[model samples]
Target: MSPERGRPPRRAVVRAARRGLGYMPGTLLIAAVAGVLGLSLGAGGVPDVVPAGGGLTVNDVTSKAFGQHAPGLPIGELRHFTIGNRLFNTNWVIAPASVRSLDGLGPYFNRVSCSACHVRDGRGRPPAGPEAPMMSMLVRLSVPGPDGTPAAHPIYGEQLSDRAVEGLAPEGRAAMTWEPLAPFVYADGSVVPLRRPRLDFVDMADGPLGPGAMTSARVANAVFGLGLLEAVSEAHVVARADPDDANGDGVSGRVNRVWDHDAQALALGRFGWKANQPTLRQQAAAAMAGDVGVTSEHFAGGNYTAAQTDAAALPNGADDEGVELSRKQLNRLTFYLQTLAVPARRDTHNPVVQRGEQLFGAAGCNACHTPVMQTGATAAHGVLVDQTFAPYTDLLLHDMGPGLADGRPDGLASGREWRTPALWGLGLQKRVSGHTFLLHDGRARNAQEAVLWHGGEARGARDRFARWPAEDRAALLAFLDSL
Candidate 1:
């Protein structure tokens, strides 16, 4: 008999029960064994299952799950969290509105609010088709510059904004067309079709994006667990760096050191698709400048290039107050992002999930999708201090091969490198954001497709997945879903 996609075989269930019941009292163990065998247990005979998120995880599975505050936030900080939530969800308008706080949107920008891209604190998907406009995703533009840094495109600057304020033309619109490739065959004769994206720039206001410009398509990632990722000790993350692959494990992970605006020095980057932003505060500030066309203390000037003189000349709301986003407001939004809770893993006790967990490690997925890390003392938020979390990422950049390359270098990350994304809330992405697209650009249609796209350092793990029997493949996916 074959195991169901999400249900483990009966034998697997029995094995899991025996293993989990070792410390149970005699009567409880007997009843657990009976339950595993499908014997009816009387009232009060059920065993207590351990919850996921290791106490930090929330059990909500609804669309609103990602928007919740972290469990156990101090009572005193609740008001601040609520204020931040309102600010995060507030839509910024063109400058000089009745409401002073929510004004100063872009003279040139992508979306009006942070929630526009994150979409309920969840992932963003690519455009549905060629006619679809890019709303939640943006294209990063750069060229090779001095000291291994990326030079902003002379005309477009760092990002291409497809929308602009009244009377001003947008830089350009971004469109995508997909080209299908030959179907990939597995060892067991199963096949998977793959598609690659072709990005097109249309209606350029300044002129042609010079042939030398390098572009990377980036989809907005989920906002949960960021504070925890931020809380991870720099020394601990650095300790995992193996840029030279000294162990010959076929995996070489490198650290991305970037400018920390508050620290006023170079610091290890742990945010963004390429790990280009050093801290969440700076990440928020960059988003304000680049995504919303709003200026803050970190980016006092609007995101306009010298070529965008028209945009630069626009009356920035900041001229009245000196900056668009105030220090208090920025801190509130940052706090809101820092406190979003990680959704608890569902169906963790199921036998199929257990089997999948074992297979995950066996396939060498753990080599880069590191399953565990401990948070050190976090000065930004006390809620994240000294917590052990399973974010399932090393937060280091790895060469994912030409298959997923954007041909754009960011900070120290090569064209083919991307920071390992956290897998904690992956299963709920479709539920929260209404899409299952994965990868940096939301190219992969599902987790399976995401795995098939892996290459370079992850070639061995990808091959292991490809070579697995259909049942094992289902098991592996089930394990990931449980997370």
Candidate 2:
């Protein structure tokens, strides 16, 4: 239910009151008492507080809209959303151990849970305290092949696992640093600095990391509304592809078709910056298996070596084999991701915000970060359609300049290319969420930093932003946050 945008029934109410006033005071009081008693007894229902034919204020519309879609989710389906929240919370701060049964936990991995990096399921900012600057966020790096393609390392390789068994600590610790660059002053006099990210990791003390070792780094992303991204049809994305840059805009869009184990074929990539993983299901499975080292039927073989496998050393019940996640649990996780609602916009009508929106369009930011695509009708979740989604991403890979490049390619994303991330959740970032680490390397500590770090095809826009006036620049940022 969208808001009621029609006229109010004020005249009708006024006439009804006039007639009621003519009734004796005693009779009116008795009638009012009877109405209260009926409501207490759960008669038909409480008359609509909003009242029929009434003009809906913004608050009324929002409260009602929220109740219809979220706050008052229909029964039965509530489990899907609620269970999704639980799984999210579980994965948020606590990692699933590689070898866990009903008894307990595992062999090898990185941090315990998703929240370790993402923190409050929001954005991750810069490294502070004792944590190394590289510790601002973890990047997953795999070595490149002779052809320059990213491939898993042969042995004593793959992603660096920092946690291992009882006696042995995990091998491979990545240490990184940040070097800030000069602030670029925009046309409007707004200035923002850029950040350069550098990485170095140590291999196992007892062993040697082979030549084919592959590396990739991941800055944690908020898991809000990912399901919508996943649900967006391949046809819609492929149609947006301007592979040859035929539009003459120099911005060519392409889909990252990747291996899909569930579908048992190649499918459109939607999740990662590379679009490397096909679905939320595959992404979650890999995260569980690779990041936390928890093996499941989805990733049966696991991404580690015998020397690297933790169960043998740590001594936990073997969840990798018999105790795997059920389809229900997996689906719940996906559902929660899909339904994680975008936060309500603040001050969308502010003049600054309106101007910023217009400037955003003029700035060509919308060329790639295209906005407003209506979700098609669906039986299970009607909320997908007509639901204003502000994911300011075309979900296609783009050649960001050298400044933003991590030099580690994955599937379809070249070292210079990455899938556009959604910008809708910025309003709550590092607030209800935490950290403002933007971009793949987590080097850009804030929005301005991220913008300043843009390069390659975005260089022109970056330059433009560098010269934007302070007030206009504030409007631009305001526009971004209003997403």
Candidate 3:
């Protein structure tokens, strides 16, 4: 399919919103919530507080908020966490180096280490423009496959690696140019400028990205609270799959069934922008192979296409098991991700944030971004089991419409679908990663832009948000920041 095939027109979106397509009134939604929870939205009462990560929540608001380990962890566990942290930040060199473990750097890869992209364990931002290099972002490429699956491009493989090891040339560099979309206008006559990214592949090592190639550029997301998300039982997540929208809420969410290397079977995908990886361990291992070109047990062998002989023939710093990353090392890295703490919500008592909380429910943002979920008893770590947490997501896939579409499919997710990202620790994005770029490709510049870019199943909530008065919108954003 053409990249622009399914994209809805800007004017059509506005007219549909005006026509009340999937739009829910604020009063009716609030009344429904009040009826179900038996809770008052009255002026005198404050909603009870729920820990953002259950026992794993931290109380830091500073720059290090996203980097903290879960509090009250045992000393032995902390030791493993420290080692994993070191490995995550380690910069790998070329193969045959003195340090055997840290050697086997990419013949073709995006960054030097995990920290290079996910700076401080927080979100990553796209380059300022075509002039700047993509330091913290990467591009995915594929051609149409036989059975609706994505096949890796013959020369560049699944990902574009702009940087290569010393001797060989890099695959290619991706430059982004922003095309301005029509400014979104509120009911009160306020206008917000919006832009979408246009990607161009330049300075190719082998050859051009031939015809029929589909590409999707994505910025790295935050790495915290993933273990908690993984612990949410598959049954619990599957129960929320209203694929047919049987309730007639105009919102249908379903799970992505993806390959699990460990289990050797299809499992619920709960990580990545499209929910493509089933577990944090597989997610980490895939990142090692794709982003850093380090081989692991989960993904063995060099990250090279058969066409790139030099890259494929490089000497690897593989251990006895024939992979650059050992099983023990992978275990430590997975443990690090599994035990990272989620930052607690701040400024809950502020009246603006409080008002925003009510508007959030009124706008039906809580339907997909479910405020609460409970982890089951099967987590490997005791701290992650049977805990109620407020991560602000249902861990399900939803069709976000063509406005935010990449026209790239993965696993069971279509071009129009994306996993609802957790909104926890959103406000501190700038302090931690130095920018507020949101969405899969960093197209949305802030939380408000992120909301306005919503469509498909979220059109109702997005339109309801746009129709609100300025004060109500501010309160809703303030409530989001509080998370």
Candidate 4:
């Protein structure tokens, strides 16, 4: 698969120009002139930014946009991708059943399948009200360990599983109620409503969670273009680390070193809310074990804690190799994630969007949301290797201040720290997921609110954005919408 396989064709650009040449920026006009003269725009600093995912990009602006396979997937790997898609959407049942392949659901789990949380392979949101259950979200549980690191709650383990298989009691039900904060008034007198989530546990099957147990509520993140992210070199990630702010940029991003289960050693953290998981494969295995209660090669045992004897003693759906999901199945699932396409950016030539892009860079948002990163030569797939993709994240941990802090440490990430999420799909979230809820906890209602919630290292950028003219703010949002 060539790196240019899915780029927007010349005709697509012509169509965009024809829609309204009046709305085109001068830079875009220059590009049009360059195109007519058979001149390349690369030398003039006019970026060819339409293909957001490099060769893996797909042009689709509909609800099904996030679920596409990466452009130019090999015929041989297509079978594995199809099988992985099935496994992701398949709902496992209770153990010792006829369909052994789809068994071993849970003694305790949050959702039955990966698609249950990440519906359509897009983002998940919190429940609309307290009357609703957490359909596409979950709550993590832990307490202070002897060395002050986070340890699993003696009974609840690492995650709170709200659902269980037949004849077994679930850990508990996770609920949330929103507390409306004072509306943020911008310099231009525009106000954006803000709300914070208040997580509560009810219907505890065992006993009360003792005092000082920490909990974090998280919505399921979109899973597309992960293969490209996984292919980004550790050296590239480490080169961006500025843990001490030695350059005085006020943006001190630090790598979160975590245990790589496959390597059995500490490695550069890349995926997850806290950048806690080292690889996409490990992240998939962990989700299967923690969210679906399905054991994989990485997590061969059930998710039950020693204290949960009833859950542990129950008949599991382990196969001949003593694991619910075999190595081949896990590999297929990982490959599926590795090949999911990233939607191409929209409205790249729109004048407002161009201004917003400029404003985004001017406000230093790019400091954390680095627009482009080159993948290493080696990847799970040939298409993902040596590609320049725009994921818009540093994948480093930064202190987000007290307002957004869960007060729950994850690996080397402190309670105030959170991994910077990619901004590539920010524009199409509403079309794909039906909701605009964002952030690790889904407290922010939209991108603007999400920006307002930023603190700590990002406070400078947030403050700059807060002080922008309303039109500039709108343009910035427009640019994000075009992403």
Mark the 10 consecutive residues where model 1 has the least summed lDDT.
Answer: 46-55
lDDT of 3 by residue, 1-483 (tens): 011123235464344333332345645654565543334466544455578888999998899999999887889999989999998999988888889988888888899899999999998899989989998999998988988688998888999999999889999899999999999988778888899999999999988999989899999999998889999999999998999999999899988999999999999999999899999999999999999999999889789999999987778889899999998899999999999999999888766665667667778898899888889988969889898888888888899999988888888889899999999989878778888899999998888889999999999999999888675676678777778
- Candidates by TM-score, descending order: 3, 4, 1, 2
Q: Which has the better lDDT: candidate 2, or candidate 4?
A: 4
Ranking by lDDT: 3, 4, 1, 2
lDDT of 1 by residue, 314-382 (tens): 877774559999998899888888888888888766666655665666677877887777788664777
- lDDT per residue for candidate 2 within 78-167, as digits (tens), equals 788777556544532212444233222235566555555545455555454223533324556567767876666655445666665456
After superposing candidate 4 on the true structure, give the runs of residues whose Cα lies further than 4 Å from its correct spot.
1-45
Could you tell which candidate, 2 or 4, scores higher by TM-score? Answer: 4
C-alpha TM-score for every candidate: 0.90, 0.77, 0.92, 0.91
Total residue pair clashes for candidate 4: 0
The weakest ten consecutive residues by lDDT in model 3 span 1-10
For residue 35, model 3's alpha carbon misses the true position, in angstroms, by 7.1
| RMSD per model, one decimal | 6.0, 13.9, 6.7, 6.4
The parts of candidate 3 lying over 4 Å away from their true place are 1-45
Q: List the residue pairs that clash in candidate 4.
A: none
